[model samples]
Target: MPAIILDDISFSYSSSPLLDHVSLRVGDGERACLIGPNGCGKTTLLRIVTGRLLPDRGTVTCAGDAGPRLIPDTEGSGGSVGEYLDASLRPLRVLFTRFEEITARISEGGGDRLAREYDRLLAQMTARDVWSLDARVDETLAGLGLSELTGPGRGRSLGSLSPGQRGRLRLAATLLVRPETLILDEPTNHLDAGAVGFLARTVNHWHGPVLMASHDRAFIEDTATVTYDMDIDVWRALARAEGADEFTGLHRCAGNYSDYLEEKRRARARHSELHAAQQAEKRGLREHRQAGARIARGGVRLARAEGMAKKYFADRAAATATRRTRNDDRRLEDLSRQEVRKPRGYELSFPMNPVPVRPGSALSARRVAVRRRLASTSFDLARGEHLLVTGSNGAGKTTLLSWIATGKPPAGAQASGTIASDRPIGFVPQHLPRAGDPGFAEEIWLRGIGELGRGILHPSMWTVPVPELSAGNQRRAQLAMALAGRPPVLVIDEPTNYLDLDTMEALEEALHRWTGTLVVASHDRWLIDHWHGRGLHLEPA
Candidate 1:
């Protein structure tokens, strides 16, 4: 039986529809991944599933105790750590109160309806194991690396926690709450390598259905049992048609991301073949009809010159032409009903051109430490060398990178260090600030790298504001703009955070080919596994 279902879900933000008659289902113990390019309505669909947003049409159903619980992209507002934990369990608290009420009503001589309600509530409680909720909470906290946040740390304000800590807290609370269906939107966004591995394990072993929207290819490949891809443009066109079916884009594939790619490739090839064949058939029919018309015209001219004997030949030729044309028209009508639409393809091209540098040590950091954030660290990077920083979340990778790239630590971070760099360095921080005066893409153009920027971004996006771009597109623009003036050194923090697989591959290739001194802090397993550079591993301070 399906644990979650969305039937005929149609939605629109403006005059144009984003999601139209989209239907999806996940059975008990199944894991489904929703993947698409940036701004393709993935977040919108996930919000609809979690009931955070309602669709213009369609119904959402979740089997079992409670509705789906979402691990959101952003954290909640002001609240103590303990208070947040308590609020997460409110659904369980409500169920417990209802159970008591139903029991009391039965004792007061209730009917069959009351007994059935009591039984249903009892099953829900049993499934959640409410008797051991406290112990489960402790286990969940520890598993997600939040054991310290409990006990003496529970009193800590949410504002005090780092962005990574806040993100993990949301994930832990959702896991401990144990809703009937679990839904996650970019769940691995703020996670480190170890934390993402833990998430994959927990999700793989989950008892209920799991539906997630993520650009983390490594995590999706590890945890997803089914892949739901909505990246195709044809699906949207079909959904907008007058008599479209409920499942406009039921492009569900079994297995992981790799399998989905292979299946989609084969399907696209078949669609192309069918379309090519239909075009050939139509062309042949048109040529044959024209040839018949030519024959009829010649026979008419011959008959007029010869008399009654050749008139019969002309009549016969005309009849044959009419029959041939009629047959071709019927064939064309049949082919129209089985027309095959072309598939959509996505591509990214990023070329980095680094400025020339003298051969020597490009940067050196001696005993660098940020107050309460980073421990003392020392490293030297040669000109044109590549260095990768590896660490768990909150282990100060971002803090260290900010110092190296900007010649200073992040705001409010007091640093004690000796960091020296002779050449200019281009930096793309984890969280980019707003672009003042010129738009983000426009900045790249002003730096005389408009051609390079065009490889990563569409020309139209050059005039758009930075805040209006999708996260993935924004990341692309950031990288393209960073290469402005061809800095001798480049520093990037979590470069793979919001990028789709294709764009990620393009960025990886560009990094490998670029002849620049590089420093990157990333938690992407796929990127890490493929890296062949020096590594700086950090432990939590």
Candidate 2:
């Protein structure tokens, strides 16, 4: 039996439909990845499939008799990591509670009706190996490098931990559940490179199916057996408009993430070529039809010879022909069914032309640092060169970026070093304040929907209230805002945190072609390694 199945699922929030008659299935032992840009309804679709959210129309079925375990993107009803981890092992907790209850009933001289139930519960606990539950949990935590979550700092609230820590904690707890099938959402968001590697290996070795939605390219390459992409539908709709039959909906690409990209690229190119040919054919037909109309307009001799009403009947026939021409494309109806306009993809071009630099470095810092955060650092960055600052969580990577971007120490940091250059700097921070005014989305977006589509955040999300979008999309929005007015010196802190794979690739290309100085602070090994410029690795003191 399939691990999960969804048929004719349609879900909508507000007037815009997110998922329209979308159907998906994952078979036994199949690792299927649902990938699209942020807010493309991947999360919503996962929720529906996992039974966390019901579709307005359709049926979702899962073969997991005990129900599949879902690892949500966000932290659950907030608690200490220990409490959260413990809560995940609900069956174990229930077994302990039932055992205590049975003992109490027997001691109180309860009747045989209770005795029968008590005996059965005891046997159940033994069979399930409930006694080793705590040991399993401990082992899981240790394996995930999250033993500290249950150690001295176990009392720490989940929210207090860094995003990466909380994410690892969730993964550790979920793994302990030992569900037959797993539903993971953005599983790589907060994971560092090491944890991602562990997760990839673990998932690959698992016995059951794994359904995940993520924008992590490296993770997907390591883990996915197949990829499900809804964005193909959008592209198909474009092709269908041009009377294309080859590409029309969600595509399941075989192999891993890299293979998926290559396959999709080939398919898209082929579809475009077919569409172009169809457009030419349609144009010729229309021209031929126009010639027939011209003949009718000239008052054809046949009209008078056969007494045919050329003005009336011929015009009606021409109208019928035009209707047939318009309806010839069967897939155009797919584009007409949705209220949400498909976001258009655009090529983003940054406009920053800096004057020629002298023989000296573009930026030079003697010794400046964030107070109690970063050690006094010194580095000289030449013009048009790239620099990456890498460190683990709480290693003051952001602090270094801030100091360089502003050419002064951050508020809490002290500086004594002299940094050169008066070039304008574009700084994208790790955290972005939410756009509270909903109209802000409209104002900035209405002016740049085309450009917005070029980045990770789609243009369709522009009209929606900005506060409601994911943290990653919000971050992308800010980055878009920053890049709109490109500065000569670009400084970014963790630019890859919440972006989809395509957006990351696009930004990488942009950064490579930039003619100005660039400095980035990120845990994204792929991005950092690809830059291959200079490195500044920080270790916690």
Candidate 3:
């Protein structure tokens, strides 16, 4: 049997349906990736499979020997990173629990009765090498870049760690468990290039079933053997007899990330070629039919009286109208019978607005330092220059950005010496409250519609709540808000979060072309390697 099976599972929130009849199967030794825009129910699907959540309908089956384990993106459970990871080792837990029971029986003078049980448990722990749980936990923490948070003289409570650190902690915990099957949600969201690389090696070599939801192209390419794309459109129309619309469900592709990309490109090209051919065929048929009708009409005119022909008899007009209507109907029927699909993408194409940024120092930080992460360093960014900040998870990329965007230091970071910037900055951080008024997003998109193009926002989605949008759409909306004012310098944090590969590439290209200074905190390797920009590489303190 497959390691995990989800059969026609359905789930919903109060008034909105998130997933409909979702089904999936994952086998042992295969890492399957779930890729799509945000808000596509990837997290919910993982939860259902792990039995953390119950589907509104249908069932989930796990064929693994041990209970499945998961690493959720969001955080609420509390513990130090090390403690959390230690707790995930179930075999160790079993050993410890039995040890306590054995000690209690000894105290109660029932040692003989429990002696066999105690010896068996001890022997099992020794045989399985469960005593080194702490060592394995430490190793995982270091691999995930949580060493700073878990090492001696460090290790804050999970609540005190940043969101990114918490995500790393969860990942460490997941890896420590070594379950027969692993379920991970947005596993690459808060990781730096180093941590991502480390995790990629661990996952690629893991000999268990892995089901992961990720938007990182490189990570997916490195680890996944199969790709499952959740359907974007849940409102698919149904036949009149069916009454209600049903979801199109998960779209499966049997290849790695690169294969999926190549397949998509080929599909689009094939569609374009077929569409052109069909249009040409339709035009030829129409011309031939029209020519035949003209001949038939001419024959009718000749068959009529010579006197009537001179007047071009009224019946000739009626016959011409009838021919046109008949030809149009036949064309419609022929077109309907032809099976062809049009290519669809993000469908957004537009040039960035040109802004006359003053040619001078856009921003400068002299000997800037964050408490534990960013060391004192001086950097100058000139107008129209692009600055790429690179570092690990707990590094101070976000902290440094906040300092530049705002005049003061971020919460735990500090800036010293001289810092100067005359250019107005627009910053898009990793996290922002969803726009309260959906119309606000609508207004911004509308204002730039003439220059931004119509395909950026669908008319039907204008009124939907911003939080209801997929992650990619939310990023697009936030970008619209950031670009609404067209500031001279743009400071963005993790701009590629939750974005699909196509849109991510588009955004990177747009920033490359925008006529403004930019300071960005990003972990996307593709963006880093391809972007023609200056850099500040930070090492974790």
Instruction: Estimate, for each residue in 244-343, the C-alpha lDDT of model 2 and write its tens digit.
Output: 6545226677889889878876765665555565566656666766665565444554356434555566666667656654654333344333222333
Please report, in order, the local distance difference test score of every candidate based on alpha carbons.
0.77, 0.68, 0.69
TM-scores for the candidates = 0.72, 0.72, 0.69
Q: What is the lDDT, from 0 to 100, of the residue 438 in candidate 3? A: 26
Candidate 2 or 1, higher lDDT: 1
Ranking by lDDT: 1, 3, 2
- Candidate 2 global lDDT: 0.68
Cα-based lDDT at residue 25, candidate 1: 91
Most accurate candidate by lDDT: 1
- Distance (Å) between predicted and true CA of 82, model 3? 8.0
* Candidate 1 clash pair list: none
- Could you tell me how far off, in angstroms, the CA of residue 437 lies in candidate 3 after the best superposition? 14
Please write out the lDDT profile of model 3 over residues 194-235, one tens digit for every residue.
Answer: 788889998887766789888888888888899987743311
* Candidate 2 clashes between residue pairs 3 or more apart in a chain or in different chains: 371-413
